[model samples]
Target: MELQQMRYVVAVAETANFTRAAERCHVVQSALSHQIARLERELGARLFDRTSRRVHLTPAGEAFLPAARQALEAAERARAEVAAAAGEIRGRLAIGAIPTVSSVDLPRLLVNYRTRYPRVHISLRSAISEEMIEQVKEGTLDVAVLGLPPAGRVVGLRGHELARGGLVAIVAPGHRLADAGEVALAELADEEFVDFPTGTGARVQSDDAFEAAGVRREVAFEVNAIEFMTRFVRHGLGVGMVPTAFADELAGVRVLRITDATARVEVLVWSRSRPSPPAAALLELFDIDPESYS
Candidate 1:
């Protein structure tokens, strides 16, 4: 079937209605229906089952959905490759990061990259670690910064370790431990905690740090947003785990290094493949080595 026909089929499959699908594809309903009918004739199988009131994918259509999506993606990628080979770095690059880094790191990095490559359009999306990884794999994101362990995963991508520093305890500026520069994780065993949401990179790191140090954290709050955690920590809700950069910036919060040697987190740069020149240029601005930032 022709690419146009496949596009029609995909649109119809997604919307499950001819009129809405046509609107999405910027075509008339009659034209879209005709294209799908032609495609079905060529394949000798009906792709969808439609009645007066309902429309749904047939078994064959369900099976073909993924393959059709891949074909479209491959076609788009081929066009992008040609555009890049022509020495024109002028396509949208979608980059994602976890919330903490997005706030602390990306603003400067993006500004510098834009200055250097003004022709290259850039879009930044922020999410927790799990969401970012999925977006990368699904091609919604060109690259992402996440906190997955460096094992038991495919390696078509490259990862750069940017910064390595231990987790620190953060509290309101006037709290008892606020004046301390170094504190053990276990020392706050009875303290209330503001924690990262479940299934996030920061949460995972926080859990690992406590487990390694043989400390059981009593979490009074488990939140999905870093901003909430920051606000709560500032109001003396409890201690929280935050990136070193974030801890340094929050005006009314005090950060104390974890005395336990095992409590550490590393900032990483990751991409599904070797990044485009624009992304690579942006990544270069980060100080992966702790000594450089220090």
Candidate 2:
């Protein structure tokens, strides 16, 4: 049967009244009845039992209604998919981002994207790099904004480098490090350090930073949330290392520059191979000047 027939059938099934369903479907009552009758005839079945005062589904109609509803939904979804592919870019885009990007970049990017494409529905997920990659591969995430290099080996995806920013040390205001303009990596050898748990994107960056400085870290506490780690640093729990942007925003902690060696963390935008047009459209908004990162 035609998609319109399916729509008419579903409307009638929901309202269980001819005039009400007709009004809801924005069709004249007589036209709605004719379409339903045409659908029933095409299917070679009596779909409804109607009297002057009441209308109800017959056994065949009861069986047909759900299938009809499903068909209509599928048709609508197919239409939307085609529309999006045609550069309409007016559908749901699922975005997964690591904690650091979620703090600032994502909000700004989403705001800009919404202003440009108001009809598009955007869903945001906060995840670490590895998890975000997994979601993209499994088709759960349309795109991901994560720290570079990817946590896992690159497989079945493409990555776009967005920006790069330096790491900063977060220390308690009263701590010795608070007085320093910049501290050497060797100075952290004896200090208690707060950092992300192993296997996290931040942890990978933290490890690389120390390795680049030819120093081994002395991590006293390993936690997931940067905010929590900063808190730990603020109360003299340990010195914390995080993105300069992250450290700069914390009120109770002072950020100290790391000296001797320059370190950088790259922000990356990634998506699975052959992403949907909606995903591609949303990804465009994430583009920023690489120079802006530092």
Candidate 3:
């Protein structure tokens, strides 16, 4: 019946193991078990089926789980609201992004944040979209700036689009497609491609295009950085995608427009789970229109 009991039940349902749930709740297993037993007795129902090898939620547990989760979430939201009203927004905020995020103007954003919340610490890291999403889910990252695939599924995270534009093909000036202003997606199907690994935003855009056109290109090289990909394209290692601005910076390359590829704008993603005080305060700076997401 208590909030602590609700936490224990939810953790157990998620982990499917009493010991792991106890660990997650930062409580001894016996105490968690005792609370659950008391709750079951109060409700006059068995919440779980604990057999020889594994534990499974019983029918009653399944029905009660959603209500329990909602109650916990409501409680947390109340706490956050209280903290926000008191201006208690000071803590570390971990952020992750891919190399393509250079366009995000992070310096300006950080400066603004520092001016408002001088006590809050911020850390940024470069990672692929998948790794960033995982870190956010694990509570290691407060935010992630990524170029997810067009309409790609992002669960348990709220995202706000930063910028949206088409992706372009970059090639050495001497390449056959250099003089072309634009080309179909299938035209480069046979070319060797030097691109970011699978989880990157650029890779997602490229993969989605190829899959839609039913064309497959050979990825000759998978580079970890956008700078490396740009270098590889200049050396004729293969054609690759580059942002229009980035293409201009890379110089010497033919930045041909892509006709069939979809360019999903980069997005700032954060967990829907309760954020720390600093994370919540920083999120406010994004000026997000929650209704747009609705």
Q: Judged by lDDT, which candidate is best? A: 3
- Residue-level lDDT of model 3, residues 1-294, one tens digit each, is 899998999899999999999999899999999999999999999999997678889999999987997787567556756766787655567889888774568889999998998867789998888889888886668888987766876787888877777778998888999999998889998899998886566787888888888998899899988788878888898999866656567766788988887876788888886566777677788886443553
| CA lDDT scores, all candidates in order | 0.72, 0.74, 0.82
What does candidate 2's lDDT look like per residue over 1-294, in tens digits? 788888888788788898998999899999999988887788899888988888889999989886876676456446657987677766667788777762346677778888887877888987778888887776667677777532334566676665666778888999987889788888987788898878787778777767877888778898878888877988999988877767647889888887653444454544534455566666555553322322
For candidate 1, write residues 239-294 as lDDT tens digits: 88776656666667888887763423344445545555555555566643322321
Top of the candidates by TM-score: 1
Give every collision pair in model 1.
162-288
Off by over 4 Å in 2: 1-77, 85-87, 102-104, 149-153, 260-262, 287-294
Among all windows of 10 consecutive residues in model 3, the one with the lowest summed lDDT is 285-294
Candidate 2 or 1, higher TM-score: 1
What's the lDDT for residue 150 in model 1? 27
**What is the overall TM-score of model 3 with all chains considered together?**
0.67
The order of the candidates by TM-score, greatest first, is 1, 3, 2
